[model samples]
Target: MKLELPQRDVGLADDFSRSEPLRYLNLFRLTLAGLFLVAGPSLHLGSDSPTIFFGVSFAYVAAVLSFGFPDAARLLGHNRLVTVQVLVDVTSLTLIMWASGGYRSGIPILILIALAGAGLVGQGRMVLFYAAYATVAVLLENMFRLLSGRETVDFFTVGITCIGFFAIAQVARLLALRAIANENLARQRGVDLASQLRLNRQIIQDMQDGVLVVGEGGVVRQFNPQAVALLGAELREGATLGEHAPALERELRRRAEHGDSAHSLRADGSGKMLLARFLPAGEANETLVYLEDFDRIHRQIQQVKLAALGRLTASIAHEIRNPLASVYQAAELLREEKRGDMQARLIRIIGNNAQRIDRLVADVLALGRRDEALPEALPLAEFVDEFIEEFDVAESGARGVVVNRVPPGLEMAMDRAHLRQILWNLVGNARRHCSGAPAAVKIDAALRDDGRVALDVSDDGPGIAEALRAQVFEPFFTTHSKGTGLGLYISRELAEANGAVLELCVTPPAEAGTTAALPGAHFRIIGRVKP
Candidate 1:
């Protein structure tokens, strides 16, 4: 990821460029002004042209004020501004030396300061350029003084001063480059730190367990979205935890004082069990808490157990097949031979029970090897109507016992074989349990508001007891003695595999609508509807 540094009105290098030269020049100007003002007989310093020196000092003050204006100061931008200030310093110092004492004046050394500042502000060859200009201006001023017969030229002093300017420029340039390098290095570090902080926050927010940091006084400092979901309440920063979760706050304090590492508590009103861990967050009073739902973990464990059982059952069923076929063949042979009346009846019973056991085995094997669904869009209303017709003809004695109320043109996407098996099991159960001519067995199908196809198979018989409702879909759980018990379990598994929901709904109250008053067992299947 690219590092993003914090922004500022002025950049580091640019601010250093303009501010350094301006600062040094202002100091030089003010110092010269002060010297000229105070240097006289009273200060034990005398000047040949004190009046001209004072006038030049006043002009320097005016130049300082002019550059102080916002528009004028920034007119040439940062880099150009620094260069201009250096040039002005050289010229002003040259004139000041002429006014003081021609070539012999010590003020010519002050020009070196301006050239050194240029080295700091400007880079590379520009440093040499500024030094060259300063040297030339000083020589010209001294030449003018000598030609006018004010003083004689001193060749040795001029040559040494000019060499000093170049030496100072090179030294200042090296220092400036080092300082810039340090600033750039520090800026990059800041950017990297910011990027790391962002990445850490993302990882914390996406964690599966809910996390919270709470102060000792119960105020919430931070919380993840999962914490809100698990607690069934919003946790705002700076808000008292007692307002949202009193039980949780009490538990947190208890765990910390007793030196416990973790605690489990149920959320108020929600009845969701949360396992929480308390860790000190590098502060004496602040605590970082992680919460995870106990029910979710239990459910995951339960699924793993069920999967193991399924594999075991598949292995056992394969072993039973060989012995079961042998028993069926022996029973069939006994029924074909002549026998006494009681013996004949016993043989028939054996054959009938053997066939029932065989069918049970077949169903169990089918459950073990259920095919993956290759779903297709189907007109549900038409499909159910056809199924009811076929079922009526197949079950001769159960004619007119099944009723359907599916609206025409309704559609759903489902595996045809899986759908057929699920519907057959539910409708057959309804048919077997019904006791009247009006047919309490009914298939109710409709398109729900949320774009799902809802199909409910309900009966008008006695409803399932609350105690047994929980186990209705469990494998090998059946109220009937002859039932294999894999029917509802396999049906639910198929429904889930196809991304559908199959649930046992509450039987409607007697005072409610007609369907509710029937008080039958209702199994509702909801799945995505095809457009």
Candidate 2:
């Protein structure tokens, strides 16, 4: 793992130091002035001491007044303000110390403020100005000491003060330059981020997909251009759930209230079907939905395909039915005649295949009609038991397929005929595909606390791959030999007619021992319980 460098341990402290130069400088100046004030009453100069200290005190008070920027300069940017304040500080220090007998008063060496300000002001001309000012002050102070002679002298101390101030001033100057450079970089980054956000918004506006941005209050804060066009909407902010697009609004509320990530929303005014891909984290209080208009596409495709299949069915019916009758009659004729064992077996095989073909054709005809259902309040426990027992799937062991544990007393409201058809499709598929597997089929149900039911009927023979799962629901889609492949397509159709959703359950990874083969598929039926 890469170790993260702490901000404060590096540039952050320097940034803070640069930003508040005046606050700290004022505090330091006040502290030094306090010391000077206290020392004032204790010192003397050739009877002129009173005048000089009074002048120094007055000058210090004037400097404090300068600390607050004038009203006109407050609106200026911080760097410029700091530069102006530093100039005021330098001028104040020069006048106060020079008029108070220069180095004689030992105040001529206070140059750290000037040094700190130099960093904020930056280099080139500013650095030279600060350096030249410091050099001049020192020379003037030393000349005063020479004129005053030994009685009030401390030349060594004066020299040390000048050296310390000059050294510290340069350090402050360099750090200030670094701070300004970093600030410029941060400003540039902000500009780039703004540009990217604008580009994203424009792209979303151009999309055919309806885009909505909702806030924490469950109000639609932003409904993009595509959303407005699709809904024929002229809505304002603060629209609540179901205000403009009821289907989408209801779904958003479902997602908000239940934290559901998947929803199918259809609105009638646009005469279009809308499927939504939702991204909801559990904590989200409002949801954004992206509408994909696949209903129009499915309808067009279904009409064209259904018409073509209708003609094909009518043409094939006579050709298939006549041959099928001949095959069945030949089998009967052979059974009536005294036949050898080989002849009898051949006749049986032909008759069985012909009958199977007839069944297949009948099933195709049934699929052509729209499924009709009569939904009624159902006891969840009774249906699961009856459906399984009536289908004879319990004798799973005879076919080498294992029936995994079943949850007892399972119940959900469902149409009896629709439920029976669904079970038949599942059992038939299990018997065919997982015939030799170790009895790996299971049917189970659970009634959740919120009155919703989840039904699972799975087989542990083979699993479907991720890539093929999407197409599994399409009509006539299958992967079996010697089969019509309409089993699941019909199963889902019946399940939906009963107001239940039938979806393919993905097989778990190999690490999950109870799951089936990687490409094997399981089916799920989900719906609400009777109120």
TM-score of each: 0.51, 0.53
lDDT of each: 0.75, 0.63
Candidate 2: tens digits of C-alpha lDDT, residues 110-164: 6655565555544444555665566667666566656866234466766676676
- After superposition, the stretches of candidate 1 with alpha carbons farther than 4 Å from their true spots are 1-46, 101-109, 138-161, 188-192, 195-199, 202-207, 303-531
**Per-residue alpha-carbon lDDT of model 1 for 1-23, expressed as tens digits?**
33332342123356654475557
lDDT score, residue 199, model 1? 93
lDDT of 2 at 495: 74
Q: Candidate 2's error at 448, in angstroms?
A: 4.9
lDDT of candidate model 1 versus the reference = 0.75
